[model samples]
Target: MLKHFNAKSLFGMSFLVIFVLLSSGCDIIPGRHMRDQAKFEPLEASSLFGNERASQNLPENTVPRGEWYDIESNEALYTGMQDGEAVENIPIAVDRDVILRGQERFNIYCSPCHGRVGDGQGMIVQRGMKQPNSFHSEQVRSQPDGYYFNVMTNGFGVMYSYASRVNPEDRWAIVAYIRALQFSQNAPLDVLTEEDLEQIESVVE
Candidate 1:
């Protein structure tokens, strides 16, 4: 049997059904069905925003904004010199206090690769890692203070720069300790006489 229906009631029911369908597709409502969609893609130019070519357009050697040298002053930052000129002719004096500090810092920072004694037989080497040359090596001994400084600043071969890890003064201190280690290893026998050895034995007793 067909029941008589009001036109207004039919129109209202149709509106309600359409609203329900739209509401069900919305992601905001829990358990609503939504088609899996990819995120909106960025414009083509946006991908190149940080590329090197963009950086090249900027001024040359201009220190980036908010970045600065860690040194105390501009003079301390870099001594302007090319290759051979970098080596200081003045003797590099050993500061006992600096050497002691360097020894402590070296034990913490360098001992893993370069041993506490600077012999390069660190634990890493004991575990089969590549061995670094000893500080006592002739090649190393021949290196000037500036050479050590440069190596610490720039690094060599597989070793990375220690400039970031250690400060200039501290780097110099490490050089002093390295010299001390070298001196101990290559000291003349005459420096340790029989009387000196007897005095040492007396102290042990």
Candidate 2:
């Protein structure tokens, strides 16, 4: 029994030694001191930068990190602005896949207010919210693509911005889908091909 007790005591002592070493090992760890070096906290006053501020101004031409994309360059892709004006186009490729993605995103985020057909008669409006302008209206149909992006990003009268909820690319996708909805309701019969006319006739019949 004494031998067993001694064994346990030795094991406890070894564990205590290990615990002390690990708990205080930060002082011996290289670079940890530098990482946690006592420096001025942000906005604290100091004479280091000649302005009596610890925060030195960033160097000139300091490009932001991950700025290779057009989004970071004040391009039409992210800000929907070009030459100080709202651009009239989508900066990305417009294709079936993009349109489909737009449709999915629009159905999720916009259909609640704009309706599936873009008629501003969604369930939310039916439930007593103010109805928004229909996208098929001539005013909206004539608007530049960037207008939609801006609205989605910054919101409009009686509408909250979707910027927090929708990413920039998805916001453009939703704009494309909105254009599709506008075309769907405003397609001129005079421009319909013979095959398309026949298809419509069959549906009518």
Candidate 3:
């Protein structure tokens, strides 16, 4: 049997065996054999995409689950825009409860840079961070409610977008709260309640 097998015949048989094994998907190299397997973690970058983002945008015209109302029907509510401009009013109704919710969300998110009263004197600013414009400033106070909502959703200047962290409804709530803050610092005498007047008089006294 040894004499019957020449060197070329043995080499040919070995090559044939390797070819069959490869065709049948044998993992000769163990862990390194699966070169085409794709594994992507959240927020990881990938060269497979032109944007190098592992997370791809949803298909056009397809709304994700539980987002149809905002994405499909109420674009203004979600994006804070109408007719190519920021809407002059918040699309959602403003109420005490909504304002309170806004206050809570704003304290957690915006207060770091905008301050508790939106004076742009937050602790970060005192610690040498760039100070944003005060909400009480005439320029800011004159901006429409949707303008603030747009800034919160899309960001402006050095501020980053909160669209991912703050939901649309809560963003509107924060906008309402910002208005309340502005009014508190610049309220007219006629709009003050008796109790408010008394408090001011006591403070002045």
Q: Estimate each model's TM-score.
A: 0.55, 0.66, 0.68
- Lowest-scoring 10 consecutive residues by lDDT in candidate 1? 72-81
Q: What is the lDDT of residue 127 in candidate 1?
A: 96
Per-residue lDDT of model 3, residues 1-205, tens digit only: 8897998999999999989887868376566557646678888998888999999988899756753344558878988988789899989989999999999999999998899999999999999989999999999999988899999988898889998889999999999999999999999999888999999999999
Q: Point out where model 3 deviates above 4 Å.
A: 1-29, 32-63, 66-72
Q: Which predicted model would earn the best TM-score?
A: 3
Instruction: Let me know the TM-score candidate 1 reaches against the reference structure.
Output: 0.55
**Residue range with the least summed lDDT across 10 consecutive positions in model 2:** 66-75
Model 3: lDDT to the true structure: 0.90
lDDT of 1: 0.71
Residue 98's lDDT in candidate 3: 99
RMSD of each: 10.7, 6.6, 10.9
Better of 2 and 3 by lDDT: 3
